[model samples]
Target chain A: MLDKKLLEVLTSPPDAAVAIVTQGKDGPHVVNSWNSYAQITEDDKILFPAGRMNETEQNIQADNRVKITISNREVQGKSIKGTGFLVIGTAEFAAEGADYDTIKAKFPWARAALAIKVESAEQTL
Target chain B: MLDKKLLEVLTSPPDAAVAIVTQGKDGPHVVNSWNSYAQITEDDKILFPAGRMNETEQNIQADNRVKITISNREVQGKSIKGTGFLVIGTAEFAAEGADYDTIKAKFPWARAALAIKVESAEQTL
Candidate 1:
């Protein structure tokens, strides 16, 4: 069963810190701290800026299964943790159309964006 | 497989942001942002402070399964996410013995601590 609080945090809008990891030749290379959000779809996918060509994306291409972890801070000793399965199926240039335009409007520094479909999700304590 | 970088970050010592979510009576109440660490165990379980008697712990008592998300920040557009399954089985007073002593030495403000054992773990992008 998933922790309800964690799910709410992961599914919350605006800004959430995401960690994207892909398999590298040497090992698994990880990029720490990127802004992300969940894409509304039948399968409940997540969308985030992949940015320009980077090692993380290349590793994802090599292996589609990627892990995404998210967290939010709290004042007391409580916090929420959300982990989900991600696979990169499509890539879109930020200069393309409405989707890209919306992303660019929010994050002007993003060059490209990656569309990820979440396969599984779990909450952690 | 877990991302090497993310695993390193989650398993790394010092300071890591953790989110702990448990079931609540009125929907799902969440306490965001707590400091945590991975407990060294034969089963690869991660242990964190439950902190006295709180709503989060109460929810866990009703349902042992809990979710824990850990994350670390980076300068670039990348971050590492670690999510895992947790079950609360034991509670220990910080003044008990070595285990509590160590935790208390590090976290002075903590009252009583709940011990959690992780069952499953995965990485997120």
Candidate 2:
């Protein structure tokens, strides 16, 4: 699950970039998302809307293991802030289900929902 | 190789975060870098310092494939900018070599040098 620092970064900028890595046939693939439809449940489950994600969606279906990293939007202190968090998780696409509908309701542009269960988390402090 | 747009993003902020993904035994791993020891050669090769990068270094040694994502530090449009870039490349650690020495000279904190040859690149417009 995301800790205090991770939550701070994720919730900082609503349209902040979420860097996601998924394995592909050629090699590992990286995707940048300014997810307007991202959500976090009280249980710490990450909900991401899938809006026309092709290779990323396919990669997850083949293997659910993914890594995500985001920078802290605010300066941590008076010094130069390089605070970042890396999240390792398993992703499941919620297509045409209750969760999908909820995400769609929140973001009309969303076509499906990506629910992520965190495996572990780390940071560059 | 990195294209015009990618170069723009990579060279924008001196210490901007670099989100990197590498494959491991258990799953994919992501690392964020504020690389004060990164260099770009005229031939389009990426030189990054391997400053105590344990897991990431091992992963690249086992498989050179890696994907990197970075957000543009500047706005690209008249409205809100959400420009991001993804780089697919192969990495090799350079230890006790000419490149390693060069990196060490530039960044005294560098332990080794990681050279990356670009394979392909994409983006989230």
Candidate 3:
């Protein structure tokens, strides 16, 4: 299940880059987004605008598994001032769906929507 | 060579999470670190204090390839206000070496040092 702390992290003011990790032919490829850019759907799927995630899209086509890390310095951790989470999930890119429309409405540059169905979110901080 | 812009991002301020991605048997695993915690060595290698990166250490043993993303909102982007970088590199953990000692001296909580030798750093945003 997705942790509530993750929702807090996303809503909080941007403090750190959100990292999206996907497997490539040679190795793991990484892309970045900000906390302000993430939108959580009613079913708990996370939506991120895809402006130029060409390599990320290609990787997901070959393998749908994705890993993401999000953090916020303003949020309280288990025992510290900052908090973060490691999200293990599966993802797909949608160019013409409700998800794409939702993201496109928020981010004008979005050509597609990177939708992540989270399997588990572990609070790392 | 590592892009000088990455250095600027690291030194700017704590505005976004730094993500460290390593490949696991199941899939790619992601971890989080802050920008203020990274230390660049004289040789241009980046070192991070490892408090409990056991999974990250294990993944690197199987495959040394690592992907890192660091971002800073304060840094000027190519055509935007924010700037970020995708770092494709090789990494290893040091428990007792010059690298370990360097990180340990700065971060008392660190039991090991996660050192990354940069292969390339591309400015993404």
Candidate 4:
């Protein structure tokens, strides 16, 4: 299951950019998505609409491993006023299927759905 | 030079978390920090106080190349309300010296300084 605090951060007003990190051939690559842009599936998988994640898609083709960081300044942390979480997972982009259908419904501009099979979601604030 | 808009976002009220991504042996690793915590140096380098980035420090030692994403919902973008940037850079941790001193002064709890020599800071949103 996803961390409850992470769910709170995602549902609340976003105070920070969500980061998606992937390993490229040259080095590590990073991209930004809004906290509210992420959706959690019934099975607890995380999904994001991919409008133009060309490089990220290419990287995932070679290696499915990915890391994502999401945070919210409005959420309470274990010892602080704000909180964040680090999500380690493997991702695959789908243009057709249930995941893609889910994302396309909410984000009409989405060309693909980035589905993440999370290994862990750890609070890191 | 850093993007002027990015500087504006960094200096203004933070609306999001900044993500620092590094390549680890296992996969891409991600950590979060607040946008307001970043400081621009006279030489145009970016600095962050390292509270306990043990894994990040280890990754930097093996490979200095890094990718950082920072964004602000309050900043105006070229074609939207919010703005974001992708920073490609190399990083080094400093325990002592002018760079370390700069970070230590502002973040008293910082054990080391994470200094980034930016190759590019491109506006992504």
Ranking by DockQ: 4, 3, 2, 1
List, residue by residue over B1-125, the lDDT tens digit for candidate 2.
Answer: 45677767666643456777888776677777653345887677777777777898999879888877766646362244646666778888888877787778887888888777888777666
Compared with the true structure, what per-residue lDDT tens digits does model 2 show for residues A1-125? 46777777666643456777887876777776653345877667778887777788899989988777766545362255546667788888787876777788887877788877888877666
* Candidate number with greatest DockQ: 4
Q: What is the C-alpha lDDT of each candidate?
A: 0.46, 0.71, 0.88, 0.88
Ranking by lDDT: 4, 3, 2, 1
TM-score versus the correct structure, for each prediction: 0.44, 0.82, 0.94, 0.96
Tens-digit lDDT track of model 4 for A1-125:
78788899888985467898888888888888888889899988899999999999999999998888889988999898888888889999999999999999999999999999999888997
Q: What TM-score number comes out for model 3?
A: 0.94
Task: Tell me how candidate 4 scores on lDDT.
Answer: 0.88
Query: What are the clashing pairs of model 2?
Result: none
Q: Which portions of model 2 show Cα errors greater than 4 Å?
A: A13-16, A35-37, A73-80, B13-16, B35-37, B73-80
Q: Is candidate 3 or candidate 4 better by TM-score?
A: 4
C-alpha DockQ of every model = 0.06, 0.42, 0.70, 0.75
Candidate 3 residue spans exceeding 4 A from truth: none
- Per-residue lDDT over A41-107 for candidate 1, one digit per residue giving the tens place of the 0 to 100 score: 3344455654554776676666665555555443111333332322223332234755555556666
* Better lDDT candidate (1, 3): 3
